[model samples]
Target: MDAFAIQRQLTGIEPLNGSNYTTWRTSVDIMLGFLDYEFVLYEEKPAAITEESSEAVKLLYAKWTKANTIAIRLIRASIGETIRGDIPVFNTAKALQYYYLTQFMSTSYDGSGSVREHIYKICKLVNGLRE
Candidate 1:
């Protein structure tokens, strides 16, 4: 599908309020991955281009910059205005992902649930952190 079509579909994802973070995050991750913008979550940003920069270095820098910019914009757009203000400004997609993980991932599991359920929740949280 074209970028515009994918983006239009992404608009269907509900904005993140504190309560819907998990579902919102999964939707955004899948959309970004489809757009090839998920790399900014894993790859370190390349050094800024200089006059003496090699073609390969320049290309890498451009690719990273484009992905980072798009990912940041998409993420900000997905956030609910009420909670968006609470998040500190982030320049990179990875930093934004870390902020969301730290803010949303609940580590404390109450003893009210079955052991299997608790384990499943723990595993899901771990997978989110890994991403």
Candidate 2:
């Protein structure tokens, strides 16, 4: 996911960056909150891994990705439901395209062809706009 790359990049800080590790953690929490929960007030649960657990860092990244994926699904469901209610508004090709555009740029990636096409169209439009 592009967000995986972005989230990883955001937290990749050198110790000399004047921002502490805690700050990066908080940033991640904030982003996660925006993607899912309204606020992030919860007990910090220690990962229940055995001593034989391998690749702790990879596991942690997977967990983070999973959490974000759930959030994306919830958001998509909500948005799709909301948009579907506009059957009256969706009576025309322009309206359908407009709605698709709205849902498109905001959609989360799930490795679907439709999603890839949406990304490609958005990128094409964005490039055109930029030029």
Pairs in steric clash, model 1: none
Candidate 1, backbone clash total:
0
lDDT of 2 by residue, 1-131 (tens): 37786466444422212123345335544544555532212323235566666787558645654554554333233232333243234322123334555655675667667876666546533422221
Q: Give the candidate number with the greatest TM-score.
A: 1
Best by lDDT, which number? Answer: 1
Least well predicted 10-residue stretch by lDDT in candidate 2: 12-21
lDDT values for all models: 0.77, 0.42
Model 1: how far residue 5 lies from native, Å: 1.5
